[model samples]
Target: MQICGGGRYDNLIGLFSEDKGKDVQNKNVPAVGFAYGFDRVIEALKMQNLSPEFENRKILITFVSDEFKDYCVKVVKELRERNITADLDITDRKVRKAMEYANNKYKYVIIVGKKEVEENKVTLRDMESGEQKFLGVEEIKFE
Candidate 1:
């Protein structure tokens, strides 16, 4: 795929200037221009088996109550700061439905409920293995 093309164009800028052949007030400007075929680049990467593996690092967060929205948001913010892809689910869906959604898209699921809030911990579930473990808020590390 021809992903991109660029080359020097000394008169390119000059052609766009108010003066017919002068890029600046009294002089021509040497310039270069480039364009990328983003779709073609993505196709090439897919063909080369180089596409991003988002599921490997993506996580879904599910909280039990609306009261814990702030806490969940804080956790999500911290995870993002660490370069971890985290998503907080505050929808009205049941926990089971949320887990199902996570299983389809994320590698891990963080579940926080009243017990977890009181204990300052979260239940982490491995979506692929169906395993769950408890970890402190500060102890969770994905990166």
Candidate 2:
């Protein structure tokens, strides 16, 4: 069974023929690539009964008002760009209710309010630690 297969420099001449001149010489390019048997790996791990540290990881963002909805979208986009599992509350819930929901549903809660928007900052609360920190919008690192 091929456990993995890969190529590093695949010369996709035919695919880019429109861009390549008709008389373009065929060049042999160096290439490498690979893929793991995910199902097999999962079965092996299951047999060993190994558990990961964090099985459920998620972040929740709550916007205090419609005016800050755009900012909420921006924050969610930033988190997603960093490969973080994040969701924004778009139910038009009150700040307190949204915060309560987030505290119950996610490990982290990012609160963005009108004041925060005006100040260009966001408040990050650790649901498990109950610790909070205010970070400038520009200071928040996505990646």
Q: Which candidate is the best by lDDT?
A: 1
The parts of candidate 2 lying over 4 Å away from their true place are 1-57, 137-143
The true-versus-predicted C-alpha distance at residue 91 of model 2, in Å, is 0.4
- In model 2, the worst 10-residue window by lDDT is 48-57
Candidate 2 per-residue C-alpha lDDT over 1-143 given as tens digits, one digit per residue, 9 for 90 to 100: 34445666467654566646565455435456677887666555656676342224477888877889898888888777765678889997887887788767787788888777888778988788989888864455532
Q: What are the per-residue Cα lDDT tens digits for candidate 1 across 1-143? A: 68999999886665677777443644467778899988888778878888665447788999887888787888889888877778999799778999988877899999988988888788989899999999975677654
Candidate 2: Cα lDDT at 94:
88
What lDDT does candidate 2 reach at residue 96? 82
Clashes of each: 0, 11
